[model samples]
Target chain A: MTAPAAAPPFHRPGDLGEALRLLAAHPEAVPVAGGTDLMVAVNYRLTRPAAMLDLTRIGELRAWSDAGDAIRIGSGVPYTRIVAELATVLPGLAAAARTVGSPQIRNRGTLGGNLATASPAGDGHPPLLATGADIEIASTRGTRTVPVAAFFTGPKRSVLQPGELITSVIVPKAAGPQQFLKVGTRNAMVIAVCSLAVALDLETRRLGTGIGSAGPTPLTAPEADLIELPWTRPGLFNDALAEEFGRRVAAAARPIDDVRGTAAYRRHALAVCAARALRRVWTAAHGTESTR
Target chain B: MKVEMRIDGEAAVADVDRPGESLLSTLRDRLGLYGTKNACEQGECGSCTVLLDGDPVCSCLVATAQCEGREVKTVVGAVPRPVRDAFIACGAVQCGFCTPGLLVSVADLLAREGDPRDPVIREALAGNLCRCTGYEKIIDAVHAAAEAMADEAHRAPARSRAAGSTEETP
Candidate 1:
């Protein structure tokens, strides 16, 4: 309560329609979801908007629906719900969610807040990014789906306009062999030094790994050498590819030396996370135990 | 913002300034429920643990607005008699800073988990940071509490049946 002298005026909309109406009228109003990340910013006076558009009462943005081919998660859905219900859909994400903060943080923090905050170390980012998620942004004009790849502009920045609201995130049904891993300071309640999420396609023999905290935005390795290929003996691609993947992950990350960790440590952790993710994916695909 | 809560079996409503303020602040400042201590404003420390609708949650992390119409029980609510007796017998109350939160958190665990193993107890209370007693006494207190509760549950039916159909043995 001792945050700042004057808090901004808050506007609580009862439904999505009223929320959209407020956003349409006041372009300067900031959308407050969860307030986990925003509270820190507000306390520090990083960015102060005149008004807050509250989304807690909007039922439309809090419901998740699976429509045969894809699952549309309302942006307001907390990570706890995702971990409990959607584990099989994306196991790696569930694993990562278990690592997010303590239970209370997971209970209150939403995937929408993670994306909107756009922190490089956000646990929700790499999993959603690797799953080929699409964000639906709504305004009075209309609603449009934007690919997650193009959603982030930089550290703590996104492609959303002032009057736009991220309504939901849609993940396609075809995602396969998903795995997420992160190394932090502790078992729980610690932000990631580096995190990675990998999804493998069994039929196409293609793999994608999204790495976070080593970059400004979530970094994706779209065309990694598939470990699912049938091979009998050791080859040059066997040992070297993992090292290459590590280097690629390091190259993709634009990490900085912060209080939590150093840039060098982040690079090292990113490589480890990326290589371990690949090994886990390979094991899941082949039904074999990973040596790593 | 108005926060209506069933606190310790009593209906209470409080008008708060910021809806986004944490429940830890609300309990301490507005409702004057100081049983939940504020150690870490973040969720790392379980000092602010309170039962939200019968589930143990860090009151410091949950927004006050979310507590509206929910049942919130603070440490002022009696620690289950078994747990309190165990804590006393095991000498778990040194400074007793973490006692309230630990008691509430452990009470919820015992109620839900039905006397978990020692390892499970450690894992369950991992979020709660206890600086005193070196944790051995606390663990002892928890185990004793669980055993006592189990004993009481076993004896309850016999006591009830004996009380109901007892013929007067003049």
Candidate 2:
């Protein structure tokens, strides 16, 4: 076991402004929330910052508001709250949250933390991508909102600048039925090897697919035109259409071979997950189970 | 840094010198609360489970600085007598490293939901990893504890009623 390094100065800002000011003053300081992922890096001496800014104390960053246009989730909101409170409003996100590590991990792990880590395997990403969420960022200068698609540049990297902090995520309410599915080695406490989320927009007659753990970053499949169906009608999905959508989703993936799984296996898993999610969403929309 | 918090219902202050020091380290090394075992520090195992502000969290993942002004209850403080006795009665304490965390987790579950079914019990203790006893005995212990606690609740009112009648007669 590695002995922990010497203690560095720690700061806990009471407000978002103070946090930003602290960040500006110490660009070397790292921001920590829940500390589930960051602490792991710290424990292994992977990266040592001169100081740490604790964001859990900021009260405004711990709330969620429904603004009619979008549901704004504060970055500090833990996964447990999302699973418990927002299941009906954001079922896809709730489903992903339910698959996170464990009860203890869920209680401390936040969506903001997951975004900050930006691991391709992050379960929070696919749901956010599927919902077309926006990332709200803040610094001492000001705040800006970026689309989730534009946020990630690579694995464990994002467009977030120094001294900037993620404040909240703006997720649009589902236009129709949506579903998230993940494949892992174990039933619980495991990271997703590959995951997929599918959403159907009844008004637009379009389908959205988000793939995870099978690419350098969370990916969105190109919009697939839904088969012509009554705008008001549900249950338009069929075996052929679902299979085509799944194949497109799998084609968008650029997975690499790793210890957990092979690239071929991930592509295969992504196809299955995409198909399963589409079927589930179809069943949900129609209020009837799919026979095939 | 000087970190202060309420641990096991007692005020505790420890000088945490390491930047990456965890609440589990502070509890075990500084405060001598060895009941909260530290098996896997990566949060993979729940050996270091503790209640922070009435919620179960992996203490190993929680920094000592984060615990300032918070209330922490280890297994010694969180586990009730009935639950502890039930674990022993059901032979659930093999090796005993995972017992502290399992006890704390079960206590929290029982407090929130009385007499959870087997699936509920399994899900509640999913974070805790026990290499021995295969978890059947632990589930039995949780059931036994719930029954024992229910029995006590049933008898308390009756005993109080009997005492009231005797006092009235006298």
What are the lDDT scores of the predictions, listed in order? 0.76, 0.86
For candidate 1, what is the lDDT?
0.76
Query: Which 10-residue window in model 2 chain B sums to the lowest lDDT?
Result: B16-25
| Docking level for model 1 | acceptable
- Model 2 error, position B86 (Å): 1.6
The positional error of residue B156 in candidate 2, measured at the CA in angstroms, is 3.1
**Model 2 lDDT, residue A227, Cα:** 34
Please give the fraction of native interface contacts (Cα pairs under 8 Å between A and B) kept by each candidate: 0.08, 0.46
lDDT of 2: 0.86
lDDT of 1 by residue, A110-220 (tens): 888888888878998887777778999888888998888899899889998778888998876545677788877767777887888877766565666678887778877
Best by DockQ: 2
Q: Which regions in candidate 1 have their CA more than 4 angstroms from the true location?
A: A1-11, A25-33, A40-53, A173-175, A223-237, A288-290, B118-123, B133-136, B158-170
Residue B64 lDDT in candidate 2:
85
